[model samples]
Target: MKNVVSYLFLLFILGACSSTKEKTGTSQAEAIEQQTIRKIDVHAHYRYARPYLSSFFQDWIMQAVLVDVAKEDSTGINRSWKQYVDMDIENPGVFYLCSSLVGVGIDDPDFATKNIERLKNEIATGAKMVKVWKNFGMVTKDGSGQFIQIDDARLQPVWDFLKENGIPVMAHIGEPVQAWRPLDNPMNPHYEYYKNNPQYHAFAHPEIPSYETIIAARDRWIAANPDLPILCAHMGSMSHNVDMVAERLDKYPNMMVEPAARFGDLASQNSDKVKAFFVKYQDRIMFGTDFGNYDPAVDWTAEQLDAEQKDLDATYNDLWRYLSTTDSLVIRKQHTRGLGLPREVLEKVYFQNASNFLGLE
Candidate 1:
């Protein structure tokens, strides 16, 4: 009976959010409109499965023009994000976070420059967005082995190009807090990669900037280009600090955030706080299920799902079950579980906020 009631309620909400032009402009209608969930999934990778995708298929993209709908379907990875563009027009559902690539870090900025030229020439053809991944911190290096953070002057042209094209860039800068070290702390989880792949751990002069420094650089980049709107990934690199994230969002009119993979922990810890954060900043939040990238061969089999679920399940468990529980679990990607978010706020966090940010109808 409880399950049935919940199902009915969910259906009701889905129905209310489905309509576009309202018939009667009643208060209920207005509330429904405001509450309606539209989503622009500002994250998800596209790859050329024709060649290089079988590897990163479990976790990233490989580069491709288009993917056959049937060939490499990732709906299991993102059940809510099907028909990437159709989601925007049909319902207040998940829209596409279309992104473009420019260069191969500082190593090939010349190539990146020419590549971007090609991109510019073809921007009108369907490149609706730009998503610069953590390539800067991971890729840029000088002869002295100095790393080029996102705000590096050489990359200014990259930012300028996006601004000129009128496409907002979702720049995911900085490695997560624990990507640099391997010690088990209350803040992070255990990962086997750091134990073996010493390179993944920042051993030498970390081309990858520190968490604080990277956020600073990212914020500075955003601040300098007031006109170039950037939806900073993982909460402006302050996913670790909700208060500061709120502060930054308040400060940057041109800035926004997407809850890519932090949903479970934050919602589990303080559901009410997460709810309040969303209600207060509903206009600024965008929904992003950090799925895609399924290299089944490299990642794991059913055996690894338990560990993986700690991270992936947080988005759902936190989004839905958070209304009731505050108990923490081992959340994914090395984050300590538990961030208790509210029900209504979860709805906004799930999709509505995303829709508004992307201007999806």
Candidate 2:
């Protein structure tokens, strides 16, 4: 009886050891998978720097480019620009800059020249790329009250300079096609935005340029600068359909795209189809979260900071899972299946492609 009891005790101890080993092995595997590849967010607008921000990037093995835009309200432009530049300086390899030209003087004869000088100065100060915002096609107007389209003849000099210097442009020229449709479907990723910002709701504002007009002008600008490299921010504003994006990608070999702030739209589509799209354009698609506005002056409590970190972790993890796994997941309150993309595709989409485009390789 004593011998049998001792043997039972030994079996229990061995079982416990096996379970512990299994758990540890699983954790180590997960850590290895998560940290194996480096990532770059090609589009972001981090206006201010915070002390805790570095940890987020380090934890994810990621870097980002802080994009600057010349908005109509210039009250905080200088301050914000300095903040971004300082952030890039502070975080040497972790942060980069993408500068933009002033849009307020598009009608002036010297607009292109002045912007060229500004861009040169910005490039000297460590700008890796230039950004042309939607203001060119949507907001900025000429002396005669006509909107200044992106393909305007006056801006040819600026494009020429970029092309000559081998600098890429990040063009965010138009709103999503859903902007032209009514806000009847809450499921649309852009429904809330158009509902809140009625000025940009093209269906309501027929006076503004139609969606087709803006997209055509953007295409013309792109085609005219065949030698120039252009990264279409926000899936070329064609997030509504992967087919449309593919068509553009096929048409313009000099162009690439980053799906900033449009992950929900991708998630809304059939997962298999989207996965195929990524596979087909694996070399051209890059990752961008559009995450920004890390101002520490808000006096956030420890609890708030903790909650914010949790949210950030979840966001990154969700995106990674969607791209790298085949698990069923809920994204933005919608049920969707993961892409289960191959490791090679993920590597290119997450880092390799962006590195090549930004010349960080």
Winning model by TM-score: 2
- Give the least accurate 10-residue stretch of model 1, judged by summed lDDT: 62-71
Estimate the TM-score of every prediction: 0.61, 0.88
Candidate 1 per-residue lDDT over residues 89-139, each given as its tens digit: 432212243634522335654855875785575455344566665555665
How high is the lDDT of residue 336 in model 1?
36
Distance from true location, Cα of 331 in model 2, Å: 2.8
lDDT of 2: 0.84
Clash tally for model 1:
29
Residue 101 displacement (Å), model 2: 2.6
Q: Where is model 2 poorest over a 10-residue stretch in terms of lDDT?
A: 21-30
Give the TM-score (vs. native) of candidate 1. 0.61
